[model samples]
Target: MKRPSLRTGVRWKISIAIAAVGALVAVALSLVVHNSARVSMLDNSREVQLERLLFAQRMYDSTKEPKLGTKLNDPALPHDLHVKMKQGRRATYVQETASGVPDVWAAVPLSNGTVLSLHSKFADSTTIMKDLDRSLIIGSVSVVFGGCALGVLIGGQLSRRLRKAAAAAGRVAQGNTEVRVGDAVGGVVRDETDELARAVDALTDALNERIEAERRVTADIAHELRTPVTGLLTAAELLPPGRPTELVRDRAQAMRTLVEDVLEVARLDSASERAELQEIALGEFVERRVGVLNPAIKIKVVHESWVNTDPRRLERILGNLLANAAKHGGTPVEVTVEGRVVRVRDHGPGFPEALLREGPSRFRTGATDRAGHGHGLGLTIAAGQARVLGARLTFRNATPEGIEGRDGSGGAIAVLWLPEHAPTTTGSFPILKLPG
Candidate 1:
């Protein structure tokens, strides 16, 4: 399974969403608290300064003196306050800085040609507000980080379960019918994910049952028809040599071939066929098969590698490929052996678009010169036999280079990849190339 990108995966999306929401809420709360606290603190400071100003006024009235407090004689007092006092204002207050500290000042003009002023420092309140701001900021950061951590932990678990289910489905698609997502670790929880896993398992089970039933029915029909087909062929052979006899013999032979092919297909579906692996020189094996089929076919040897595989299945695959090329393609068929691979090329009109796209279907022949020669089981059987031998068989239209037909058209090429080691008992065919 491929890992998803961090920027695009569900885990990151979830984490980011949670963190954003948490940060927004945290900031809003901090602003509300800070603004309210600042207003209340400033009001209290103003009231304290007012009480001090009234006290100074009372002392000046009783003693007939204007110098009532140390603040009235302080040099830091703004000149504007004294000017406002001299203009005979009842009371005056203003915010100013004294000795580099924030302070509120209030003044009352006395009849003795003097101003009584009161001052209060706000340094303690300001320090407290700063500390609160710092604490709120730290708390907001902690909340955002905690939300992200929680989101990641939950998202990781959810993604893991989904990935397991997807991987199981992939295995089923690749022909492993026994795979089931419901058999995952951490047990099954009664949730939507569990339901999905169960549904997939049920579907796989149903498909396996239906395929098995079809295989059984096919195998039975083929087995039953074999006896009658053999009898017909025997009786036709006993007939006197003539055109009629030849016709009967040919029809019977065709019937027998069809039945045999059907039976082989049934075996392949049920995996009843097994490979008998043996060590053989790859070059010699391919050459022998080609020699038996056609003497004039060209052979190219790039490497004399050896392999362990089923000789019978290998021959069957090669023979079918060669027959298919000769029937549908042009002349000068070429077989090349390099390492553990064998490629068969024919110079003729290339494979039809339908065949190349949909692959070979049983009894469905390609639209070509040899369209009515035989049933389309040659390539199908070749593919099945290659699978049984733990090899990969693929077909494609040959490239148009030095190999072109008389009509200036490309041909078809079939490639078979054989592993160096024998196929495992479990039928898993992993490609393993041996050092030359």
Candidate 2:
């Protein structure tokens, strides 16, 4: 199994911590047991040796002989015990390796100027200690393994819960207000994870309610202004054909457009608009729409593709993009259709930093259009309509690739991607060549 990264999540950290603590405890216990066993065995061996040496010394003194019985007459005695016996010490023992074999030698002085020595090999105590050491090693390994296993189990559960909550919050951020963090697993007590989930769910509900209320207010305001706006437009049109009358007409038209755009936005917000999907030839659709608006605009097709979409809404999206380019960009607007993507590019001072950063907003104009006359709802409406059609719309500065006199300078490109299987017809349009 692959080990988890310690830096990435809590799972590995917890597991490692548990294993380390377990290893320390196991080592301490093993050391304590090993030391206690060694001390106890050595003390008992020394006491037995002393008792035998004293009995041998008393027998030698009574019989007036230099040697005692075979039990006390070992020829492999260490020289250190003989030297200690000559110094009048009654009982003495020393550890030694005689003939390469480890043993304890004990001696006692005999009354006939001789010494009695007893030998006890360390093999018995050594064998017992080795067995205990092996057992301790096995036990330590089991402890570490068990601790790590438990830590991984707990940490994995916690990480999964946190991930679910984070994913739900992400959906809410992306305008999915219906998402909620679900309940805990069976038999699992509620903890910080559950609390966080509840908080996110509550936040989503509050946002949904607030947004719905705002949409209702906006729709009501738009409906109420329609009557007055119509009256103003009628009054302006009835005036004489003069500069002042034209100004009044223009302002009235702008007001009407704003009110209509606001109403449309309100409807989209409330989910009142639904897509009516139909099969259509995408390349031909673009060509026809651009021709009606401005024949001078060039159309290029790489791979003609069909798409299933609401034609009215698609038209609105493309219309807004073309209109924005014409109003703000230089001449020669270009539309390219390749597969499921449609890109509208213009030779202009590209999109402003704010628009690219914060996306489109109603009534917010860019630095390029200092007059601020445009209501800034074109791109916003296009984006909203694209969403309704289940498509993605992105705006960016066009790079200098095929265009002449442009060296990676300013230009705006709006790309729209349609679903793959939304085709009604399939035919390729020849690529058009435009003068640089």
Candidate 3:
């Protein structure tokens, strides 16, 4: 199941990183500005307090009274500053108040063991700094919000481009070599995403070239061998009838079959290949086909199903699968049918890791030394036919690791699931008698 949103995780991760960086920078800048302003305000308050203390001393010397902000041994003065004054050292102290304001206290030792102290509150500076701090906070928030918005735009663009590239790669993987990441490779070599798009496009081109070359070679070889193989078959028939003649005829027939398979593969590689649909009693048809192919293969119809498919192509696929199993797998191969699905399993060394990982490749058989191997075109041809039929084909080891081909444990299993072409016969098809 897919999520509701088309947005990828990379987008959100990028946006989050941008938002976090913005928030961190804003907080740091706000703190630095706030602290600097408070320190400057305190310094100014201290200077004002000290000047007032000097005036108060002069005022007392002349009129024996203190100024409005100045006092004689003021108890309101900071205790620390008062102690300093009593020790005969002029001092000023800054004190913070709960009302978001601060007071500066200054004192001097007077003659005859008296003290003159002055203190002033930073009332105006407090209100001004409060407004400044509020402005900083709002600006910081705006910065963070703006950064987030920018990040969203950038992230969305990047995600969309990367997805486009990925989609192109997916099409290429599905054998659509014509797909290209043309416009998806946006910008002038700016980022890794753009580079990735270019790389995928290049890979598609290379794959297209390689497939074209392979198709040509396959077609040429198959056509070239067809005449000679057919001639050989004719020659074998003309020879005197004996065991040697039968062996020659069999070899020539195998050569002919190989040539035909190569031609089929080449045709399937082309885009013009198509399926010929026909309705059939799928289980009955499969049972008959299984019997004619090999009498030893055990086949069962679990639930009968009627489907529309190309019977000739289906037979080809089944024939190839059975032949592959009998040649490279252990004895007692089994075939099961349920609905529109058919599974072929054999007891053998199982599929190798390379075969499981990379599906079937031409001329690459995953068989042990005992069972022998073929040209490796069997599974590959079946896979191609499945594609034409719009079916899903899968290969896997039916048994657990290290237990394959041992004590009846299953080895490789190939499943062919055909899409129901909306068969007119909606009900289940009757089960057919299968061969022993």
Candidate 4:
């Protein structure tokens, strides 16, 4: 099954995270620089204001009244500054004026229990300080925006490399051995993603080698046994007139069947094989398969269904599933057809936990009757043929919880879903023999 793609991809996540941190750092640095610059500007202004206050003090004694931004006990003075000056203290304060612009005030206590005050147009406050604050804010925002862009660029490059590697690995898993990392990552420097690509490449090479070796071995063995198996069957036929002859013929036929199965496996593993597909009514097709197998097996068609598939390979799959159910399961075996899907159910104890978990294997039947019969190749052949038909075959034990099996108490059900959507492949006619 294909894994669901991420909604918020890694690159965007990286971009957002970097932008968030950049925004935080930008805001913090702007606050610090703005605060320090504000304080420094105010201190310099305060020194200049104090000098003007001294000059105003000299003029106060001579003029005896306010002039040139000087005043004596001006009622407009802030109440806090007035209280401080009356208490015999020089005071300076800044407050927003009625015009919404800030002004600086200076006050001095006089010997006659009066206070003298001076005001200066809060010069340089309009231009230098306002400009500084605006510049800081703009600079901080620009840094954050630039950082976010940079993060997106870098993250996109990285994500592309990772995505390429993942896609290549997926292709390799699907048996494409030629895929490689090919030095296709961003930046000159190497990283872990590069290493992952290399690893996938190496893994593909190894898997290809192993599969080729196994296929060659299987084909060679089956080819070698073909002539001998034929000879054995021919020899048994010459003596098949009594009980011993019958047993010999049966054993020889079984051997021939085994050899044919191995050859078919080798052929199925080869890439050159292709399926011959035809359209058929699924319900009628399944009934024919059922009628040929066991008249006792029940058949149910939930809906009228038509499918394009290799009837020969599909027949092999269904035949094996039915034979397996008849051998290992209890009575009342049933075949269900719905759409392009077929299900074979048996009323005995469900499949072995090992088979249910890991699927079928050759020469390893999951169960045995009182006679200890079964070669374990039935489901294995079915699964192989199903793959050729581009179908899904799943086995599950029925339980109270759901149809997907875990408990063995409710019997076993094997579901086969044919995919006419995908191009199916098949082989020559089956060996005309039953599997395990």
Candidate 5:
């Protein structure tokens, strides 16, 4: 059995309820009218019969001889009455007869030894009531069907408008940030759909303005930095090495590193530089990067799992972690990879407790720190890349008890966790399956 929908504004439900109530009331009223008519007709018939009996009594009193009144029964009354009159030689008997149907003949004894009978025919109230009931049923049915159709039409129209508004809102939420829901034609505007459309339009306009402002700022910063950086690179490359200046070489290399880091961070934000998505073995990748870094550290690959991610982006995140560990952390820093989670634990004097709480903030670290880290932008850039690849990066201190840094101080750990994609059980099928 198909169940009825519980949606509000269902015309069929309202129409059925109204028709059922109307039908019941019509039937009740029809019965009342029918009974009332029958009773009234019966009362009128009884009254006329009583009057005839009274007149017969007066006639008998005037004649003074009861024989004339008794003999009146010999011929009986007219055809209007169903009565049998029989002569008993000494008296007469007049009996009214009926067939137990609606049409009945009633006879009553008069005071003067005479009898009067009144003929009553069947009442037509039943026929009138039936006609009335049929009229009510037909009217109710017509109205119900028509009203239901109208309601369905109106409901469908409203639902369509709401669907459009929902689609527009979904786009705005997804960062399209430029979607609009136009006005609906021939529909009520006080509903949720109108409110949603207005909200979507307003939100899209606001997002567009903010995004435009951010784009202008990013572009200006990149251009200002690019000019001097380019000039420095070009001038350094043209200098005569016959002079063989160690200071010049060191400064030039530092400038190049700074420029590369800047460009890499900028590329991370550019939409056109999205990393290629591929399924990569987490254990193998972590081991390879650890081999390359080799920071006199205890590196452990704890997980044997696969993930779908951008390889280049993942490498960049790991590279920054290893560099930070080697610079700030002492020798024998620990590198651990478990599933998609990677932790670069360091055995150095941990970050200043207060500063550790606010770690990775932009420009918080000085350019000429003990480890030569600059402006604290490496972790920030790595965090940006991790976010783009849907990963998380965090910093925390190592075990407080017994564990000491290479410098005989407490140590800190930075952990990075990425999500692993589950394996597909079947190939070349629309339906999804999990690996058993």
Candidate 6:
């Protein structure tokens, strides 16, 4: 089924809700009042009939026969109100008599062994009921009509204002940052619109600022690239036939590294660097990482394992770990690898207590002593890359007996545990298979 459009105005919806509630209340109240009035009228009728019986009894007691009670009938009495007896027994009821007018009759048995009846017309009450019925019908019609009219008026006003805001939002979505939502009507009174308007205006201002900043960055990049490209081209044209022209070679190499780093950062920003997954032998990858750093450190290998991962990201992660260890800790950094797990320990003052809890936050480095060498983006980048690859990285202090202030001054240990592939007992491990 198709969903209802959100473009409908809030005023209309609010009005509809109010109308529905009012209608329900009117129905419920009318039912209660009508029933109550009917019950009261019936009770009053019964009471009047009882009163008439007492009056007739009084007259019968005074006189031997019901002769005085028969004279109780008057010209002004209701046609239906007349004394009557059935088989010498007295009875009372509200019913039409021989004259065909509604009346209340009260009957009594006299002490002299004669039946007597008294009746009174309830014409006023019947007329009052007819008037009340007419008034109720008119009142109900008026209530419904008034509620609908009010609802429609309110709904139209709300819808018109909301439409303006929606149009502003549409312009924003279309990249028109300058489009602003002006002061608009909102709330039951006039309470909420100001805040919403201010928020939208602020958002538009921020977006414009960001767009301007990006434009400046783009201009700067172009300016910076020109000189390097010209230098590279000029050096290539004039081949210096000297013994290992170090200056030209170095400049070219430096330029290449700078360009590559810039491109890589751009790729990272765009989220376009996709991992190429392959079944890699974990033992070899770990061993290769530790060996490449070539730190004069004792490295240990544990549990041979395999995992499916991208080699490029793995190499970069390991490079970051080794570099951080080399910079922060003293010589003899210990490297250990087991099934999808790698740990690097340095005999340097362990990560400061504050930074350890903060994890790899910006500018919070474990190696404050080497702060002059490089800004601290290594751990931050590593943590980010690990998250992208769905892996966990953690750090802790390694308190060996000689590692604190004694011999292994200023050392910290970082443990990286990657998930191990679930075992497949049916096939041989990758490394053990015969060469293809």
By lDDT, who's the top model here?
A: 3
Q: Which stretches in model 4 have alpha-carbon errors above 4 Å? A: 1-8, 50-168, 175-195, 229-252, 302-306, 353-358, 363-375, 400-409, 421-436
The TM-score that candidate 4 achieves is 0.69
Write the number of the candidate with greater lDDT, choosing between 1 and 2.
1
Best by TM-score: 3
What does candidate 5 score on TM? 0.46
What local lDDT score does residue 162 receive in model 2, on the 0 to 100 scale? 81
**Ten residues in a row with the worst lDDT in model 5?**
426-435
Q: Write the per-residue lDDT of candidate 3 for residues 1-436, one digit (tens) a residue.
A: 9778765477787888898999999999999999898888788778877887787788888988877667776777777986797689998897888886777788889887888887777788878887998999899999888988888988988888887888777666766666677565566547888677778788777777898898999899999999999999998999998999999999899899889988987887775567778889889998999999998889999999888888998999999989888887777899999999999988876777667777777777764552244778888888887887777778888675566344786677888888866322211121111211
Please give the CA lDDT of all the candidate structures.
0.78, 0.76, 0.80, 0.76, 0.59, 0.61
| lDDT-sorted candidate list, best first | 3, 1, 4, 2, 6, 5
lDDT of 6 by residue, 1-436 (tens): 9987677557767777877877777777777877788668766886777676776577667764444244333343433333434245555567655654467666655545454565567667667767777777777777776887788887776567667677776666444455677643344554345456667878888876785666456445745885786677578657776756666776666565445444444344333345566788877777776677674656777777778766777777777777777776666788888877878778766666545666665445644565654335566556545544445677777563234466554467776666554322211111111110
Error of 3 at 8 (Å): 8.3
lDDT of 4 by residue, 49-129 (tens): 777887778777787765567777788889889779767888788776676456788888877877778876676666776
**TM-score rank order:** 3, 2, 1, 4, 5, 6
Q: Candidate 6, overall lDDT?
A: 0.61
Worst 10 residues of 1 by lDDT: 427-436
Better of 3 and 5 by lDDT: 3
Of 4 and 6, which scores higher on TM-score? 4
How many angstroms is residue 312 displaced in model 3 relative to the true structure, after the best TM-score fit?
A: 1.0
Candidate 3 whole-model C-alpha lDDT, 0 to 1: 0.80
Count of backbone collisions in candidate 6? 8
Better TM-score candidate (2, 6): 2
Query: Model 2 over residues 279-396: C-alpha lDDT tens digits?
Result: 8889999899888978999999899888888899999999999989988876668899998899998887667766777777777877745335577888888877777776777777
Candidate 5 residue pairs in backbone clash: 303-339
